[model samples]
Structure formats: structure tokens, C-alpha cells
Target: MTEDEALELLIPGVKSKKLSLEDERKSKDLVKMLGYLPLAIDQVRGFLTEAGYATSIDKYVDVFEKHKEKVIKPVGVVPNAMVQRSNLYTTFELSLAPFVEAGNEPALRILMLGAFFGLAPIDEAIFLEYRKVQPAEARPAMPAQDPWDQIRFRRTVLSLAEQSLVKLHSQQDRFAYSLHPMIREWLRLRVDTNPRSVITWRPWT
Candidate 1:
């Protein structure tokens, strides 16, 4: 309904003895409608998987269990990302070499870190657990990915944007860049590519 029509339908209840009459009728109507609520609950529970309830007996079988009352069970996923990691490293050797030559160390670091995080922007649990070193230890002199780090990262982003290795996504208040498919493919190759070949682009002072 339009705003005018909705306003017309509203009673705009007044504060008076008539309020009790209205309340009584409304309460009766509510109770009448909800009298069969238990039946409705049973139907809803059967039709939908509530939280903490078992959906299966085992990972491979259908022996369901209850996690909690009304809540469903087995709402978890195991980490099985190793295979994808292995595949990514074998394919993008060519794209990585150029960044090394271009001396884009910050960008290179971000890309490598992205790989370790999986093919996702979300920090992967496995990636977070296996720290080569903390960022402070890893590159102490270089600033963290903070406002200052943006100076270097933004420069790298623009550089990559020029080569179409990355694509920029901008909103009114926030902006970020993502790897182009080619860059994504190359970063995946990090798993298998030679560690020695991946050089830091930071030049000697």
C-alpha cells in the first residue's frame, strides 16, 4: 500500500475507555490465531533445520544428532584447501618475475601474503596459524598496511593498474584494489614457484 493508504487504514487509537474494548478484541484475536502454535512449531521445525540439531550421523553417513535445543548440529566445515594451494603455485611463474624486476617490494609482499591467505581476501585460519614471521619481524623498516603504508601500496596499485595486473574498486568513502585474473593466476603459482626467484623490489640506498 502507498503511504497515504496505510495512514488511512490506521485507527490512530485515542486514550480513553474505548481502548479496553479494542485491546480485548485484539487479544482474543491473537489467542484465537495462536491457539495452535504448538502444531505450527512442529511444522516449522520439521520443514526447517533449526540450529544445534544433527543433520547427519557421521561426516559420511546420515546419523543426525542435536547440537542444542532449537539449534542445529554439524554446521561446520573442515579445512581442505591444500590441493588448491599446490595447484596455484605451478601456473603463474611468468607474471611474478616482472614484479621482482620492477622493484615493487610492497606490492609483491601484499600479493604473496594474499596467496598465503588462500584465494580469498578473508584471512584464512590456516594462513594465520602458519606465520613465517610477524609483520614487524618480516619487514621491520617498511611501514605496516596503515595510512602510511597506503603511500607505497597505492603507488604499487597504480603501477599494477597501468599494466592491468590489478583493478581498482572505489566507493564514496573507501577504496581497494584486487588482482586481475592474470595476477590472481600468478599469485596462485606462488605455492610451487622457486622461492629464490621472488625478489624484494626495494632498491639499495
Candidate 2:
């Protein structure tokens, strides 16, 4: 996003006023370091706003830079789950924590499966088929006699979409989904560190 766009997003509902030269420079530098990504920008804005540091964009930048190297490190390669310690990574994790805490394993499994696929639109049927063959432990709490049950599957997918972990697409009468690039990277790091996570990259034929 351009400086103007980032400014508008960061300071919503504010009247137009000329920023002091120093503030302008700090805003630009902050946006650049945020990679122009809306998610990260919004998180930073929220953090600053909540902490009464909205006017201290430069200070936030300093804090961001302090952890910048750690944030850029490959996930799962680092020990102790500290990969999530960075602000941006923590933002994503907080978005995901509710589902895990709720024992929504089906939704998490669907997310993990999508992450295993590249960050591209995946056919919804892929998840359904995978669920069908997965062992009892891997399946959601659907009717045991109904191997083709879709109630739980659809619910889980929609829940994931609501969380912004995946984007839903419609084509003709069918549906597909894609994960955000940052989310894919986070999941990849999780899979790398988690030896027990089930993931496969083979195209569904």
C-alpha cells in the first residue's frame, strides 16, 4: 500500500490535516517495514492505539525492528515455539487460538491440509475426500455410519473462512479456497517442527 493509503487505514475517521515532516517520514518508514500488508498494518495500528502510542509511530518502528530479525526467521526451525513471539506472528496465532481452545480439531485439520497444498485455490472436494479416508482419530465427530457426512466438514470450512485463515471462492456451482501467503508460511513452520502432523503435497487425482 502507498503511504497515503496506509495513513488512511491507520487513522480512520480522522480529518485531513498536514502531518509534520518528522511524523510523515516516520509513517512512511513504518509502512515500508510493515511490508505494505494490510493485516500487519492493522495489527500494528491496533497495538499502538490500544497502548496510547498512536502518535509514536517511530517508537513502534523501533520495537518492530528489535524483533525484526527473529520475525524473519523460518518457523519451526527455531526452538521453544518462539516463532510466535513476534508481534505479527502472534497476531495470526491469536486469531487461531480460539479454535484450538474450543477443540475444533476438524477446522484445524482442514486448515493444516490447505496449508500443505500450496497457497492457491484448492478444490473443496479435496478436503471432503481426505476426511473420508482418514482414520477415526482424524475424523470429526460426525455420524459414524455416515461416511459421507458433510455437515461437520462444511461448518469447519466456513469457520475457517470467518477467521480469515482462508479465502473462499465460488466458480459455477462449485467452491474452492486459498490461504494467505503469510498463513501458509506459519503453517509450514508448524508442520516442520511437528513430526506428527499429517500433510501431503500429492495432487488429488
Candidate 3:
């Protein structure tokens, strides 16, 4: 998206209140900070619209600057990649920060595991099937409900979808999901840095 397009997306249906010049400038700064990626822009829209957020665009940008590096690391950069992976990392890190702060580890784990499933449309049943074969004792611990359960799993996936981290698709009557190829590469880059996790999950992938 162009900067103007991204700004429009950042604030849709805003006839109710006019933004100050400073606010408009901050909005443009945010759009550029998000690297003009539509997915990142949409995720920022969702974050800003949440009732619990209770902050102005400038303040959110201030907070984002302070804490972005703490959330996700940039790695495995290559020349001529289609999108700006570093900016996506920062944007995605911001999206997941709330969940991380609230100790929603299950959502985090499910996200990481999905990256191993390749860049294809992931059938939701894969999680269930994996859970069925792996003993409960062998499964990784979840801070809350076992996300492997169909109901809990779907909810987690929906949460991820809302953040624009995963794209939800309905195939026939069933659910499947996909990630943008750049996003998938970023996720795999994340996994590559965590050796223990790679060892535990590689065979299954």
C-alpha cells in the first residue's frame, strides 16, 4: 500500500472526530514504520481499536519504539527478499505482545508449530492428529487450556487470525489456514534460532 492507502486503512470511517495535524503525522510515521505492508497495517488497526488499548496513535508509536526489540529478533536476512521482514517482525511482535504479557503461551506455541507445517494451507486436523498420536506426557505444556483440543485449538487459531498472523480459509465445510510466504520464512527464522525447539519438533514437520 502507498502511504496514503496505509493511512486510510489505519483509520477507516473516521468522520466522527478530526485528527490533529500532529496525529496525522504520527499516523504516517506509523505507516512507514510498519513498512507499508497491508497485513501489518491491518494488525495495527485491530490493536488500536481494542477497548483495552486506551491510547492515542502517538502514544502507541512511542510504546512500540520502546519495546519492539524485546519481543522478536530479526534474523536470516537475505538480499532482495520480497517484503521487509524486519518491519513485519516488529509489527507482529507488537500484535503478540499483549498475549505474551498476559501469559498466553499456548497461542504462542501453536503459532510456532504452524510454521513447521510448511507454507501450504494447513488443515486444522493436523494438530488433532498429532495430539492423538503423541502421549499427553510427551506434549509440551500449555499455560492455559490444552490448545490441542478441537474447541480450544480453533479459538487459538481465530486469535492468531485476528492479529493477521495467519490467514483463515474454509475448504468445503472444514477449516484450513495459511501464512504469507514471507511470514512463514520469518517464523522459520525464529525457530531456527531455538535449537531445542527445532530438535523436538523437526521430526514431526
Candidate 4:
């Protein structure tokens, strides 16, 4: 409060935010629960997108058209997820649903890995070098365990294929995947997006 306001508060008194120690602990728990909300929502979004083309729940749900059956709540039920879908999560899923259906978890992981690698062109040999595990630090979930794991290899090819985010071609000997128009088109938009331009300096420009 300003000096004048402080004087007025002394004359009349005012309430302020004060939390008890117990409330602080509860608040921390609430925050931890809230933190997982985004992660759960992300997983659910991925699951639903892989499931099918989802739209607003209201889009297909017509109160007039729906018939109530013997149940108290009424048997003719459309889904809530199907009813209200328009935000970025829903829209993105709709765009990528086909590929997701064609390519599941393995595929999605592969595509994300490619995105991380600057959307570079990739083939099995190149993929082997980049994707292979270090002998000193290999984990069970990594690719090196079973080199002939088609399940592991195809996960990547299908994901890129489904999003139209990549161009995938294969020869008799190996498979090749390259960044599709998606990243190429998206890159141009980042020309002046250097919020950290201070750190992103040049040697001679």
C-alpha cells in the first residue's frame, strides 16, 4: 500500500493474504497434482488422436435427435470429448490422425527424434550411427538390443509418413527418411524469432 493508503488502513485496518503452515503443505501437494495435469492431457491427446478424427462433442450430439432409453440419465449418449473440440490440441490431432493411425507409438517417437535432429535426411546407416547406443551406456529400451527389430525401425518410418512430415523411401538394402515440407515451411517463420539474440551472436556478419 502507498503511504496514504497505509495511513487509511491503520485507521480502518485491512486484510492480507496469510497462509497457515498446513495450508502451505496442501498448496504444495495441489501444485504437484496440477503439474501432472499437462502431462496427462498430453498423453490423452496423443491417445485420442491415434484413436480417430475427434471433433467438438456438440458437433455430433443433437439433443433433439438423441433418444432417451430406459436409463434415468438417458441411454442415447454422445461423448464429451466428441462434443467440444476446437482448441490447438484437438485441431493438431485432427490434422495428424491418419498418420497416427497408420503409425503408432514407435512411429511417433521416430518422428519426434527426426524433428530434434533438425529434420535431417535419414537412412538406416545414418540412423544406425545416430540411433545406435554407446556400448558403455546402453539401456534395454534402446535400439541396439535387437538390430533386426523391424518393430523398432518401422516406428520411425511410419510416423514421418503419417504426418506428411517426411518423405520415406526404401531400397532393397535400406530405408531412407527425409524432412518433408512441414519443417521447411515452418523454418521460414523463425527468421526473427530470436528472443535470445543476445546469446545467438555471430563471429562476423
Candidate 5:
């Protein structure tokens, strides 16, 4: 969407009531800052219209500027993809902040490792294999003698799905999940940021 379309989307009633000149300008700038992507726009709209985020466009823009760098940088650029990778990364990073702050390593590990699998709907079994061999640091904290099990596995993966970081697919006998391609790239970028935290491996054959 163009800046005008995004502004209207950000402010649902823009057509009915005239916004102040200052507000109109700031809103358009905010839309541009969000990379003019509708998903980013909608997420920012939620921030503005809802509680617990910046109260106004000015403050929200400030928040985005401050935290954007905290998101891992995209490693390789793709030309003219429908979604801007930087903004998508920033948007999801902000969404994931609470989990990170809470130190939910299991959920974060599941999300990061899932990206290593190709874009196909990943079979749950591959994640089972991952849990067995992932680096000690990357593995979720649990008792040394206790084994990770199916119930715990589903809980962690479901957490990622709840955040929209991964798409969950349910079949009659099992569950599978996949990430959006760009999001997969973002996750890989995250993994690349800290080499010691990840173990090298080929994507499942």
C-alpha cells in the first residue's frame, strides 16, 4: 500500500474526520518507517490503538527507531521482495521481546532451529532429532537425567505458533509447521549472529 493507503489503514476513520496537519505528516512518515508493508502497518496500528505500547505515532516511531537495531540484521538482501525484511524482522522481534526477557529458551530454540529446515511443512520428527543433538547451550534447560518428551515438545512449538513466528499444520496423526520464507531468512540471520550458540548441520534430507 502507498503511504496514503497505509495512513488510512493506521487510522481507520481518517476518511471521516480530518486529522491535524502535524498528525497527517507524522502518520505518513510512520508508515514509511514501517516500510509501507501492510502487516507492519497493522502491527503498528495495534500499538497506537491499544494499551501498553506508545501512545501516539511520534512515540511509536521513537520506540521503533530505538529498538530496530536490536533485531538481527538481514544477512543477504533479496531484490524487491513483497515484504521488507528489515521491517518484518523488527516487527517480530518486538513481538518476541517478552519471551526473550522471560528467558524462555526452549521456545526460542525451537523457533531458531526450525528455520534450518527448508520451507516445506517441517515434520515434527526432525525437531525431535534436533533436541537430541543441539548444542548444550542451545538446548532448553531441563534436568540432566530427565528426557524431553512429546508433551514438552508440543508446548514449545505451540508457543512459537502463538507468536505467528511459525505456521502450524495439524494432520490426523501428527503435527507439522513451517515459517514464511522471509521469516526463515530472518531466523537464519539470527542464528548467524552468534556462531557459538549453534551447531553446524545440513538441513534434513
Candidate 6:
């Protein structure tokens, strides 16, 4: 979708008369940075609406500019699919923000680990095994005596699936999960950009 079309769909009753030319330009820039995806645009709209004092298009544009390199990048099979590539990353970050903000360590670790496993379906057993071998310091602290409780790990994975950050696929009696390619790239970018995040890929035994 074009930036204009996305803006109209995301914010009903947004008219040219209500927005100044500079604001319109900033809105367009924001939309472009978001890859003109309806989902991403809607996410930004929700964030802005919630942040009443900081709802200006200009302010959003400034924020976008700062992280544009990390969030915006081209990736797709088809030519001219750069924007579509960006759509997934932009929306993925929006979906992930809540977990990060709440400091949900289990959920964050699940997501970060999932990204290392590639975009294909990841067997649930792999994560279960990882939990068994994962060091106590690696696991999120829990109220229960066992920090690596399997039940808590399962719940965290399910929550990530519910948020659409991970796609859950079931075949026959077994279930596996996968992340969108864009989301995997976004997570990789996060690890690369932040010196504090420690992510390592290890074969599932």
C-alpha cells in the first residue's frame, strides 16, 4: 500500500486541511520508514494515540530516523519488495516492545533464541532440551524453586505465538514454530547493534 493509503486507513478522518504541509511530509516519511504496511502503520497509530503528549508526526519521524537503519531494510524474493520486507520488521518490533518494556525475560529469551534457529519450523523439543542444559544464570528467575521450569517456558512460547511474533504450525500430533524471515533479521540486527545482548546458536542435542 502507498503511504497515503495506509495513513487514511490507519487514521480515519485525517484530512489534508487538518494537517499542515510540514506535518503531511513528516507523516509520509514516517509511513515510508514503516514500509507503508497497514499493520505497521496501525501499530504506530496505536503508540501515538497512547502517547498523547508526544503524538506529533514530527516527533515520530525523529524517532524513526534514529532507528531506521536497524528497522528498515530490503528483503524479499520479488523485485521492488523492499517496502514489504520492512513491513514485517516494523510490526515485529511493535509487537515485541511490550515484552521488553515489562522486562519479561522468559519471553525475550525465547524470541531471541528462536531467531538463532532460522526462519523454518523449530521443534518444541529443541527448546525443552535447551532449557535442561541452559545454565541457571541463562534462565529467567522464577518464583518457583526451579528457574528453568518447563511449564513456564511453554507458557512464554505460547504467549509469543499469540502476539504473532512467532507462527505456530502443527502437523499430525507434533507442533513446531517459526519466525518470519524479517523478524529473524530484525532480531539479529538487535543483537549486532546492542553490545549487551548475548546470543549464540547451538545444535539441539
Each prediction's whole-model lDDT (CA): 0.36, 0.61, 0.69, 0.39, 0.66, 0.62
List model 2 lDDT by residue over 23-90, tens digit each.
77777776666556677666666656655765478766665665554444534245244433344565
lDDT of 1 by residue, 163-205 (tens): 3444565556445555534345434432333454332322212
TM-score-better candidate, 1 vs 5: 5
TM-score of each: 0.34, 0.56, 0.77, 0.35, 0.61, 0.53
Show model 5 residue runs off by greater than 4 Å: 1-32, 36-58, 70-83, 129-146, 193-205
**Residue-by-residue lDDT tens digits, candidate 3, 33-52:** 77888988888887887635
Model 5, 57-132: lDDT tens digits are 7876777767665453334434245337677777677666666778776667667766777778977776567558
Judged by whole-model lDDT over C-alpha atoms, candidate 3 comes out at 0.69
In model 4, which runs have C-alpha deviations exceeding 4 angstroms? 1-93, 97-104, 118-120, 130-133, 136-145, 184-205
Highest-lDDT candidate: 3
Off by over 4 Å in 1: 1-97, 116-135, 138-147, 180-185, 192-205
Instruction: Give the lowest summed-lDDT range of ten residues in model 6.
Output: 196-205
RMSD of each: 21.6, 7.9, 4.9, 22.5, 6.7, 7.9
Better of 1 and 4 by TM-score: 4
Q: If both were scored by lDDT, which would come out higher, candidate 4 or candidate 5?
A: 5
lDDT of 6: 0.62
State the lDDT at 5 in candidate 1.
Answer: 28
lDDT by residue for model 6 over 66-182, one digit each (tens)? 544455433222324565665556556655677778877767766777777865798767655655787656644222225346567567767777666777777786667787776
Which portions of model 3 show Cα errors greater than 4 Å? 15-17, 51-53, 69-83, 141-148, 192-205
In angstroms, the error of model 3 at 46 is 1.6
lDDT of 4 by residue, 173-205 (tens): 777786544333222321222343211111111
